[model samples]
Structures are given as C-alpha cells and as structure tokens.
Target chain A: MGIQNKYYGWRWGEEDPIFKNLGYIQNVLGYIDPADKSFTSNNFKELFYPGDFDLLQKSWKKYKKGTDHAFEMSYRFKHKDGSWRWIKESGLANVFNTSNNPIGGIGTIQEVTDKKKKYTQLKSILKNVSIIILRLRQDSNNQITVDHISKEALKYWNIPCETLLKDEGYLRNLAHKDDLVGIRSALSNSFAKMEFFECRWRVVSKEGNINWCQGVGTPLKDKDGTCFLDIVITDITKEKLYTEQLKVSEEKYHSLFQHSPQPSWVYDLETLAFLNVNSAAISKYGYSKDEFMGMTLADIRPECELENLEIQVQKTRENYLNFFDGYFKHINKQGEILTVHLYSSPITYNGQKCRQIIAIDISEKMKYLKFIENQNKSLKRIGWMQSHELRAPLVRLMGLINLLTDQDSIGKEERHYINTEIINSANEMDIMTKNIAQIINDAQLKEKMNDVQIIAG
Target chain B: MTYRLLQVDDDPVILFLHNKLFSKYTNSKIEQFKNGRLALDYILIDNGPDISYLLLLDINMPVMNGWEFMDEICNHGLENSTSVIILTSSADCTDLDKSKSFANIVHFIQKPLTKEKIEKLPLLMEYLALQD
Candidate 1:
C-alpha cells in the first residue's frame, strides 16, 4: 500500500484522488506534522489563517492522548479575497515515528463560513429582541430546569442570563410574590398535560420596577419522561395601563350621567330613539327608564308640535357641533302639556351619533306669565273705573253739594229736588264701588286658580 | 253770528249745574243732553249753518262718549262748526292726551261745570262777548 494507504485507505498529498477532484470533495486534504506542530497541505501556506495554532495543537494532543477517538477541530482559514473563513477538520491519526509517537495525520477540511454566519445572526437577533424566549425542561421526578434563556431577559428583569440558566429559581424569583404560586402552577399544568402554556404575571425587577408580562408557548413531552416548554414572554405594561385608564374614564362618565339632577337624555339622531335617560328624566316625564328606552323624541312632544320637532331634529343633524337652545311643548305620560326649554349638545355615544338634552320644565313659568298679563288687564279696568265711572257719580254729588252750599235760603221744592238728586248720585256711587271691587276679586280668584293648576300639573 | 252752548253728560245733575252756570254768566241759551249721542243729534238736526255751537263734552257716557262724539263731529265735516271743551271727571292724563288728537276739541276741563270754569273757556267767552 502507499504511504497514504498506510495512514488511512487513500494516498494523500499529490496522489490523493479526493483532493485532486475538487468538484467532488471541495475540501482540503492535509497532513499534520505532530513533531513540528504544523499543518501541511496542497495550499497550506496560503490558506491557513495563523491565529488558532494553539487551539489546533491542544485538540491534536487530546486525540493523541486517547482523550478523543478522532482528531477533530474547527478553525479560521484565509479565503481567496483575504477574508477569514471557518474550516471544520476531521481525520484519523494512523502514522507514528520510530519511538511510537504519532508523527502524521490525514484530515479533510471543509469551509463552514455560511453556517457560522447564519448562527451568528440568529444569536444577535435573540440577544437584542424585546421578547424573551425561554426553554424549560421537567423530568419525571418533577425537577424543573431552564434549558435555555435568551439574554433579553437581563434587560427587563435586571438578572444575568447565566444566573437564570444555571438556577431556574432566579427567573422564577423575579415574579411578584403574589404571582409566584400562579407561575409555578402554570408550569406544572403545561408539563402534566403537554398542552399550550399561557399566563400573564407581574415581574418585579431587582431595581423595584414592576412590569406586566404575558407568556405564551407550547409544551412537548419526550419519550424519556421529560417535558419541554418553549415560551415567548412580552412586556404588556403599556397595554394594561391604557385599558385600566379607559375603564376608569368610562366609569366616571357613567356616574355623572346616572346621578345628574337635571332631566337629561341621549337620543339617536337618525331614528330619534331615546338611547339613555337619567334619573331626573325618568321621574319628571312620569315614565320608567325602560319605557323611555322604547320611546322616541316625538313621543314626548304634543301632536300639535310634531312638525316643529321634526324640523328641529333636521336642523340638529345638519349642525351637529352647534349648541342648541330652543323651546318645545312636551306632553308627559299623564297627558299634561309641559313647556320645556331644551338645551342640547351633540356627542358620540356608544358609537352612535347622538344628542344629549337637558329639559327644563318651564310650564309653571309660562302659566305665571299669563296670569300676570291677565292681572294687568284687570288692574287697568279697575283704574279706569276709578278715574271715570266711579268718579262720574262723585262729580255729580260734588256739583249738587256746591249748589246746596251756595244758597243762603232755599224753597221747599228746590230743597227736595237737590236732596233727591244727591240720593240718586250716592246710589250710583255705591254701585260703581261694588263694580270695582268685583273686578279685583275676579282677578285675584283667577290668579289663585292658575297657581293651583301649576302645582298640580 | 249766532252762538250756542251745549252741555253733554250722563249725569243729570252735572247738566243741571251747567245750565244754571251758563244761564247766569252768558247770553246764549244752554242746551242739555244726557249723553253724547243726544248732544250730537241735537247739533246735527237743529244747528244752523251760521250758528257755531260750543259743546262741553263729558267722557264715560252710557251710549256715546266724548271721544266718540268728536269722531262723529270730525267725520261729518262739522269740525269747523263745532268747538268742544272736554268736560270729564277723569283725572287721568291719558284722557287729556287723547283729547288733543281731535281737531274739533278746543281745551280739556276737569268736571263739575262751575261758573268760573265756563267763563274761562275761550269758545264760551265768544258767546259771552256776544252778550256784551
């Protein structure tokens, strides 16, 4: 056999068929000089990148000392363009010197630069990503161990990745005291059932900063009674805070709407349906909340004012942003017509274009104003009677008295005539006084009646 | 020129007092009517073309009023022939203000037709001048 055949089964160096056919092997075939601690190959001087000679010597010595079955190593080599390339070498040491020390070895070297580049890119992505990817293993004895944990956990939990991998308790300890038991149970359940694991827990960092996290993953059970759970955890603190704030704001507005003192309601613009009614509205309209919910804006208005209500509704829709103030005659459930001053503002409610209205029942005020007008007329008539009618008879009496006083002596006929005239004038004066009194009494009675009607209505 | 004096009132006593006062103070014969309608009729029926009548008209009458009589007087084109002094018991300034709107009205006088009041009337003084 040839010297290459003595080393393995093929002749190495210039006669090696694998090395000569670069298309088939695409690898470097080389021989190691164990005494000189050097590698010799077809292009060894040009290809060997020099920095890893110590590592190569250490790996070769291990194989020579029977620590490894084959001489296997990975080192950097120079590419044609002067860039370093990863090379994986594997060989058998079969040649020995005279003293029985292994002097030569044959190995095949293949470039692994693309594979190393891919591995390096994956490592970089895992280290910087906000999401923490973790793999946990559990044995039949229920012993839980962290198989792998990404470095991103250190950025959030402020704990080292090595510390978390060696002792899974450090990662578990980062959970809030209240969530520790839950986290343990979640893991136990996923391992027992080999199902998907999903949990949200609070993590308190070493610096006392608390963050909300959501973890989701699946568990796979192995034939050796070991289960593996690969979970991806994300910080959900921002999302949780936003949801809580929204809830608080909604509750605050709901309380304001429910407890308002004025009769208020919200109605849909298109259908005119009553979407919401406050406590004051329910009581004032003499309708229950459920009843109001079933009614429309037109239902509360008098039939005579229905056309006006539609025109106003159309105006409100066209100018939604305008603050509306107007008057309407509304009829309650008891059929009492109410004059209301309606103030409305447009708002988006429950994803519907709606208007919130505050109705001030001014029916009593209107009645009072009418009563005052009638009273004014009555007073005018009384004043006119006092000036003209009532005073006419008094003027006649005054004239008669003057006639009587001007005479020193009077005839019997003259005296009787004057007395009779005075009597008639006094009678007229008495009747006029009664008429004035009657007018005042009638006005007062009408005012009292109006007051009663206002209170009852 | 012939001159006449007329007293129109709903109260008979006021007319009687006016008759006594006018007869004593002036030469023209005093005509009495219970209301404006009667006074207005007497003037329309008996008043001659040459006779200019001085009417003392009272407001607040049963049938017709001082203002209504003036309205009729103006409507009939008798505003030039009739001189009216509003004789009313009303102390209200509104009635006095209303009297100024009529073209036939001469002055406003508060009632009880007194001798001194009748003498002070400018249209009644024309009748008194006729007596002199």
Candidate 2:
C-alpha cells in the first residue's frame, strides 16, 4: 500500500461540529495529508471531473430520502504519491439525526489505482481501434440507451466526442433514413434472441457523404443482469461501391451486344462452345436460341466442308485477340448453300475468354458477281468471232471490188471471170454478217439458260 | 531438187491470187489446194522437202485446219521437210500461240497478205533463191 492504511470510514454533514477529525485521512481519500475540515463543498467538488461528481451526489441525495440505495461511483482523487488515482465510494447516508434528517454520508473509500489504470488503458486502446465498438441497453420503458461507445464511433458517425457521453440522438441521426426500419427490427430481434445481430447500411457523415458500414452485435449482461448489445462496426464502403460499379458495367455491355443489328454470337475459344447468341444470329442461322446453344460452329457447315472447317479450327489455337474476316460456304436449315461473310474478334464473356462473331449473308452479292463474270466471258468470245469471221470475207470483197472497177482493158472472158468472183465474194460477205448476228444471240441465250440453272440448283 | 510454194486455203480466190502473184514475179512451181488435206496428199506423193519448199497455210479450212495439218506433218516426220507460213484472218492470240508450238510454222501473218509481207518472209526469200 502506498499509504499507512489501505482503507478507512468517514461521515460528514448534519451536525454540531463539521470539523470533527476522522482518523487516517491519508488512507480514506489517498490525500497523503490530513483532511482539512474548513474546505467548502465547492473546494471538495473541484476534485471530480465536470458532471461526474454530480451523479454521485444525486445517488447520495436519493439515499438520504429513505430510499434503499448508496452513492456508488468511481471518481478521480489526489494520491499520496502526488498522482491522481480513482476512488470508489460506496455507502449509504445514515438518517440518525434527532430531527429525522440525514446526518451526512457514511462510506468506505478504496484506492482503485490499478483497476482504474487498467480500465483507462482499455478505453484508450478501444478509441484507436479500426472498428467501432459499442455497448447499448434497452430500459424497462423500452427506450434504448447507449451504455458505452468507443472513440472510433466518431470516425464515420460524425458526432462530437464530448456529446457521446451525454446524448445519443446524434448517432441515431447518422444512420441513413431509409435503413432505420431495418436497423430497429434487427435490434429488437437481437435482444429477444440474445444472439448476434448483423446488418449493412449506409451512414451519412456530417459532410453529407454516404459511407457503407457493416455492424455485428452480440448479446452481453452487466453485473445487475441487465442485457446490452455489444456491437462491432466495420466500414465496407469499398466493397459496396465495387459491386455497384460491376452491375452498372454489366448492364451497359449487355445492351450494346444485344441490340446490334448484325448477326452475332460468342463462343469459348478453347472448346468451340457457344456461350451466347443474339436474336439476329438466331434468325439468320435458321436455328432457335435453344438449338444454337446445343450446337457447335461445325454443325451448320456442309458435310463435304468438314475437313476444311477442322483445319480452320486448329488454326484458331495460335491466332488470338485479332480482327479476323473470312468468307465461308454455309448450309442453312433449308439445305441451301449460302455464302456467308464473317467478322470476328476476341472478348471475355462471363469470365470465359471467347471470340465474338458477326455474320453477313452475301448470297445475293455472289450471285450477281457470277452473272457478271459469265456475261464478260461470252462478250469476249463474241468479239473474237466477229473479227475473225467477218474479216476473211471483207478482205476478199475489197480485192474483188478493185478488179470490177477496171473495165476499160478487160476482154469478155476476163469480165465474166471478174463478175463471177465478185458475186461469190459479195455472197460470202452477206453470210458472214448473218453468222456474226447469230453468234451474239446464241451467247445471250446460253447465259440466260445458265442463270436459270443457277437459281434451280 | 525443186523449190515449190504450197498455197493451201479454202478460198479459191486467195489461192488464185497467190499462184498468179508468184508466177508473175519468179519461176517457181506453185501448187494450190482448197484445203490442207489435199496439200498433205500432194506432199506425201510427189512434193517433198528435197527442194527448199515454202508452205503458205490458212488456219480455218474445209477438211484439215492448219494446226491439224502441222500435227499430221509432224507425225509423218515431215516437219523439217518444209518451212510453213500461217496466213489467216483469225486474230485470236491463242491461235498465234498454237501456231508457234509447231516446228514447221516459221511465220504467222494476218490476212490480206501483201506483196511486201510476202517479200519480207525469210522462208519465201529462201525458196525464191533456190528457184534461181
């Protein structure tokens, strides 16, 4: 013991000599020196913190009015070692005066230096803790009272430290307005079940910024068997914000991929498995959405083209994350071979790496191209025939025409020979001209027949 | 040894002009046929390349075309026996390419064969000198 004795008893108020000596004042209040009786209530009250002594006085006054209670409180007092130590004064005031009024308080004082030091250290640690800790209780009237709150509560609750020991209304206001009903219900449930209660909600700070917090409360009981809710609060704002952003981005991508006009599908690159297909792809491929889901890319290809499709599939192993364009001969549900053009790119869908493909129906374009090529080939053939067939007869006609123009030196036999040759060459030129016309008409008819065959085939 | 000009064409007028033109210019045996088949028949019998022979052939004829005529001459091992000239109105490049494929076809000339074109032919010049 730091003092001569470890404990003492004393009484004051209601009487003849207010300065009566009580033995061992050093032990009674850790005073180190004898207590001076001349001090007023104001001088003695100076030893306590603001409003802390008032609670002890209220309990003492209540005990003096014939109530069965005591002034039991912990307050700071000066120790003999010139340091402040906590003292617990616990005793009832006796109503032993002749006037039936109280004769002041009778109590034993204990120097709670070690207990107070430990409690203060725990409180200091709780204040600096990352997560907020709270002990709350409900009274008989069902009014909730916060029994204790650590300094950490002010980090997100936005309440002042001084007001935390006095009022709890600021903490209630810190809760988001929309989440009050849920929190009240959970609190009642937790109290009734005497189990852990957990929930997450947004809290609005004094600066009007909202932060998400998760609270977990466990049931606890004080010395008087009164139940209190002991809760731990954690700021979960980062996780909550990440989840919200993920949902928003997923919605954006879904709208972009679904509403595109081109026929589109996505497949897993490793397995060639269809992961997703849009409406345009379903209609263009002549398959229902379910049918597409069940089939691979190889299913729609013609049987004869399987070998080529396999080669292309194997090549996909090396080439990744590139824009690829190709023309494929595809067979639809109607067994019609259509020329399809594809544009593909790499993407990640639902955590699966895949390639997205956009297909275009180029059957009509190919048909028109083939028609033009056929017409061009025939046109070249007709031009060749016209030059060769007509030039031969034209050359002979020109030569014969030169002979016919010479009539002055010509005899009768020479004139007949010239006339016969001229007539023969002229008739040949007429036949050759007719042959050129027939050749062009034949080429046109042949082209038309081929066009009809293509449509039928 | 004799040097001869074999003018094989389907047109009688072309053959007559060819025979008359060479006869007016030089003393050479000029044989005209209506087709390549008759010309080939004459070459197999009497006319051979013991002399410097010049064969002026047309591509499109009645019995045997110029290409078939060259094929037959090659089969008979007579491709080296005569120097041939292709005279035709066919302006197709494939025919020119086909004509060059034959060893006997030394020149390809287009129709309306002029005196200058005939004089310009090395085969004709050789045959004319042989005649002298």
Candidate 3:
C-alpha cells in the first residue's frame, strides 16, 4: 500500500498513526491506525523493509502451517534527533485468525549500538588479562586443573592449551614427585580449614627442565558444599636456590660450633654468666652441663683472686680495656687447682653482652721455670768463684816472678839456675790456672752438650 | 851501719828463709820472732833501742796473726823504731783485700820467697830511707 493512501484511509487499522508525515514515513517507521485493523499494502512500506517484510511474510505462512515462527533482524532507523540508530527487531508471528487464516505479527525493536560497543571493550580487557594471569582449579577429588591460564603460563609450560588442558594429570605431572605428597597434604589441610595456603614445589615442564613454583591457593565452595581450589603460581627458582644456600651456610656454622678444637665459651659479660659453652670447654673445665650452667665466671676463679678479677672485669665493661690475658687459678670440680693462662675478649653475642675466654693450663710450665731459676743461681755462684778467689793466686805468683827477674848482680850460672826455677814455678802456676779454667769450661760445655743431645733426640 | 831486722813467721822454713834472705840480701842485723805476740812484747819494751830497725810480719800464722799484732801494737800506740812489711804464703783475695785496711803494712808478698824478691828490697830500703 502507498503511504499516503494508507494514512488517508486508515479507519480500519488497530490504532491511529501518531506520526503520518511523508518525510517522517520516509525516514522513520511510524505507527498505523487502529480502526484499519489489518495490514494493507500502503502501510506495509512504512511498517517494515522489503527484506524484513518478505521474511515476516514467509514466517507467517510457515506459522499457519504449524511451523516455528519466532525470528529476529536488524536495520538502521532515523531517531527524533535525526541520527541513524542500529535497531534489532525480534518478533513472534501469529497467523491464526478467528477462521485460522494467516494475518499479522508483533515484534520488539532494541537499539543495540551501546551494547555492542561495551561487549567489544570487555573482550579486549579479558584478552589483556589473560596474558599475565594463571588460574588453576581443583575438584572435590583434589584433581588440579588449569581453568583459565594466562598466555604467559602457556609459554612457561612451553605447550599449547589443547595438549595441556586435555590431560587431567597435567598439574600433578608438573609437580616434582618428591614434593607431590607434601603439596597435596598442604592443599588438603588448607581446604579442610577453609584457609588460604602458600607452598613451594618443583615443577617439571614439558621441556624436561625443573622449575620451582610458589603457589598461593584459596578454596571456593559452592552452595552445595562442593569445594574447589583456585590457585595462582609464580616461578620461584631463584628464591628457592637462595634459600638452599642459606640452609647450607647455617649447617656449616652449626658444624663449626659443635666441633671446634679450642675450648670456646660464650657468656654474658655484664653478669659474668655463661650462655653457651662448647664440648671442649665442658670437658676441660671438668664440669657437667648442669653444673657448669649453675656456676659463673667468679666461681671458676680462685677465691683469693676473685676480688682482683672483679676489678679487671669492671674495667673491661667500662671500655678501659678490651682484652686481657693472665694467670688464673681455676679449681676443678674435684677441688684441684689448675693454673690456667686465661685470655678473654669482649664481643656482642646474640643481642646480649658477652665475653669469650680461652684458657690453657700452665702449671707444668711454672714448675719447669722454677727448676731453671735454681740452676741459674748455682751457675752464677760458680762464675763468682772463678773470677775472684781463683784469680788472686795467679796474680801473686806472677808478681813474685817479676821481682825475681828484675834482680841485677848475680853470677851467670846462678842466674840461670834461678831463671830455671822461676820458669818451673811459672809453669806450675800456669798448670794450676789451666786446671781451674778447664773445670769451669767443662761444666758449661757439659750443660750445652746435654741440651743439644736432648734436641736431637 | 846495720840495723836489727825482726822476721816473724809460723813456718820454720819461711822464717829461716826470711832471715837468710834479708841478711844475705841486705846489710842489716837480724832478730827472729816466731809468734806475733812475742814480737809485740819484745818491741813494746821501755829500753828498746832507738836504732833503725825493721819488722817482717807474717799473716795466717798459728799462734798470733799479723793483723792481730798490728792491731795490738797500734792500740798500744807504741812509739816503735821499726818499719813493718807483711810477709805471707797466703794468696787469698780476702787476705789481699784485708791488707788495704792497715796503714802500717808496707807490702803484701806471696809465699816461696826467692833471692830476686829479696833483692827487690832495695826499693823498700830506699823507701825506708826516705821515711827516716
């Protein structure tokens, strides 16, 4: 039907057309007259496009034949603001009249441009988020599955999603066999407690390289009480290696502390109380673990020397001295005095004031020194005798000879006889002096030779 | 003119040698005192000669020592007419050290007196002459 004829004679349509101008009809699809009560040829051009009308007409005919008739189409329509808006038209056709003849259809028109634009933006956001996020899901059976993994996770796995997602054992296969039991236990415990959990485990990738992963997981429970785990995993290979190194260093320190040779001790310097002592210290000091802990540094020092030691210790605390070494008399548990050469130094220990002391018993050394001193006194006495009492006689004998030689006026024969006697007496004196010197030299050489023999032995 | 020289010694041989050596070696009259006490008594007499005399003192003697005789004579403050020289066979450093404490002691001689040691008395005679 022509637009003008349909609008001029619209007395049998369902409702009066609210808009009927030709320019409006050309740009917009306006309503028809209610009095017309039937779709005619003139109104068909204004009501729907040729393609839409054909489709609706065909659908209406199919509906009369008892076929399905609901369908939708989209087209551009002019709005009141003079802009073309994309509209989606959806309708259900009813071709049954009072006599069950094919008649008309009704539909809904919706502007879908804003909805389409928002859908496009949401898709882009999802795609970008997929690049960095790794999502995992675990079923009620503790079966881990990659629900929505990031592209980065796929790259890290070095496998396509088709190959990875098809295997229900994919995550379990990636977990190190040694850590699988522990990881499962932790995850189960977290699920039971409904708490978040974090764990470190090794993952063997598709490329057969082991990679450490730190996983943070939270449980999601449905209304039916079915719980599933959602986890995020990150590569923690560097952190795991560093932690292992720290563990090794701690073990080394522990070994050194336990097996060091010197009898080392750590104590509270301010209180003069022991905090820790090595095995050597306990054994050397002749005290058991309980007994040693019950005693203090003062208890170890001799009673007579404690007062002087206290003064020195106080000076050390005041920074007037930092280290000290001296003789200290230590009484063992059996009440035996052990003369120890004690060396002590100040150090900060485990956030406490402390001192470290090393002691070596020097009682045997002192005994040896006393023996040497007595020997030295005897040697000095011998030296005095040789230099004084023994020298006087030799001097006097020479003096007498000098007097005899100086005499003048004597016969040659008598002089020669006196000279012979003088020479004989001088020779006798020389023998006596040589004997005394030999005695002293022999004593000194004997001592030296014995020392050399001892060294060689 | 010769003067009397008294030689005191605990050893008979040393006394004989001193007497022989002094008489033979010098122009002097000789007297003998075996003990320092007897010499001290004889020299302390009131009518003792004012003539020049000499006394030879022997230390380390049996009855009376040279140091004792010197102490007694000096203590008596005797105006003696004799010069004294200490004669001994002792070569002890203590004896030599002790000799320096006496001002009257002329000389310290070792034992086994010889002719040469006697001849060296000329120097002592010269010293005595200077003293007179």
lDDT of 2 by residue, A286-353 (tens): 88888888888887789888888778766775787677789988787778787889888888887887
All candidates: DockQ: 0.46, 0.28, 0.03
> Which one is best on lDDT?
1
Q: Tell me the spans in candidate 1 whose CA falls farther than 4 Å from its real position.
A: A1-167, A170-175, A181-249, A261-263, A280-292, A295-309, A325-341, A360-373, A408-421, A443-457, B1-88, B91-132
Cα error, candidate 1, residue A148 (Å): 7.7
Residue B128 alpha-carbon offset, candidate 1, angstroms: 7.6
lDDT by residue for model 3 (B1-132), tens? 435567787655445434445545455545677799888888777325455456777776667888888888778765355567777656457778887887666678776566666668774555334332
Local error of candidate 1 at residue A307 (angstroms):
4.2
Interface RMSD of each: 1.9, 2.8, 6.6
Q: What tens-digit string does per-residue lDDT give for candidate 3 at A1-457?
A: 1222121222213332222323333433433444533344465344543365456446534444664555555554443444544445455555455875434545554556466667567656645432224455656676656666555444655443454556765556658788988887887788778789888888776677887887786878867566766666777787788989978976895577567765667778777887877787777778887777777888777798899878878887887337888887887776768788888887667777678777776765665565466557656655555553443344444444544555663456645655565565567567766776766676677567656754763
* Model 2 CA deviation exceeding 4 Å by range: A1-249, A268-273, A306-325, A387-390, A399-457, B1-132
Error of 2 at A345 (Å): 3.9
Which candidate's TM-score is highest? 1
* TM per prediction: 0.59, 0.54, 0.44
Model 2, position A296: C-alpha lDDT score: 84
